[model samples]
Target: MEVLSLKVNGDTRCLAAAPQATLLEVLREELGLTGCKQGCDKGDCGACTVLLDGQPVLACLTLAALVQGREITTIEGLAPAHRRRCAESPCASKQDKLHPVQDAFDEAGALQCGFCQSGMILSATALLQRDDDPKRETIREALSGNLCRCTGYTQIIEAVERASDEHAGREHRPRAWEQPATEPAGEGES
Candidate 1:
């Protein structure tokens, strides 16, 4: 067992993991950070997305030892900050409100099955963080790595646009040729 120190969920944890252990496995097995799901163990699915030094990376393909002394942020780490604010008691709901990206997903109905929500949410948030007002092609390019089998792309794109608007306070949702349009209700029926 080798010792690996990684900053996870706002805390620094030194864990003993196997040499062949992937970062995703160590997070889930040793640190109990199950927020990084085990999907397609080969890194095809972005379910294991984690922030390495504030950048999105596929944890499933990362080595546990390689993350030593590096900052790693999981979905649990990047949860809407307001969600943790408690009243005098621990059960009180937060008042600061959800992050605009999260709220946009809800508003646009981006998540249907919830499997790819974490990856899509955080990756899109990262993109918006870099470019406050991302064009649809930019959003599409930034999110090309993630795959959502539920086919929520329309709502997901809408959610990203909404998030960019609220975060940047800029009215920049353009109907571009590269941007996909929502299918007419039931007209896509095969």
Candidate 2:
């Protein structure tokens, strides 16, 4: 067994894995991150997609040992929730606070069986990181590798577009704590 050290989801992780084991195996089996699915095992299906150093990569084909010093981000990493309760937070309900791509997927009804949702979301995330306002064709090209047997790609594309719109909107919108200040009550009545 080879001990590999890598950063995963902002945490340093060390696990004993076979030298030839795929990153998918290490992530799912050792790290207990099952979001990256095992579909084709040949890197063609894209269901095993993850962000390696902020770029989309097929975990199934990436050797765990080869990525020892790189950052690996699984689907779980993309949708982290703060420890605080929704009632105590000013952010929207927990669901809306999920990664924008995930929120877009949910809002657009882009997911059905959910087998490919993780990969699709990650792919969308990577693409958006590069282009905050990608055209439909760009969204299609970004997600071309991920195959969803149910949604037929229309909803997926729509989801990415929606996420892009939201991203743009967020850039213009103030933070939850930055709502426009209201004038003091009856201040002008003096």
lDDT (tens digit, per residue) of candidate 2 on 1-190: 9888978987889989988899999999999999889999997889999999999999999999999888889988886645323425775676645787888888888988999999999999999999998876778789989989785587788788788889888532211223457888767755
The digit string of per-residue lDDT tens for model 1 on 22-141 reads: 998998998888878778888787888888887899989999898887878887777544465533355664433456677788878898898888888878878987888777788888
TM-score versus the correct structure, for each prediction: 0.83, 0.82
The number of the candidate with the highest lDDT is 2
Model 1 score (lDDT): 0.80
After superposing candidate 1 on the true structure, give the runs of residues whose Cα lies further than 4 Å from its correct spot: 80-83, 87-97, 171-190
Off by over 4 Å in 2: 80-92, 95-97, 170-190
Q: Which candidate wins on TM-score?
A: 1
Q: Model 1 Cα displacement at 145 (Å)? A: 0.8
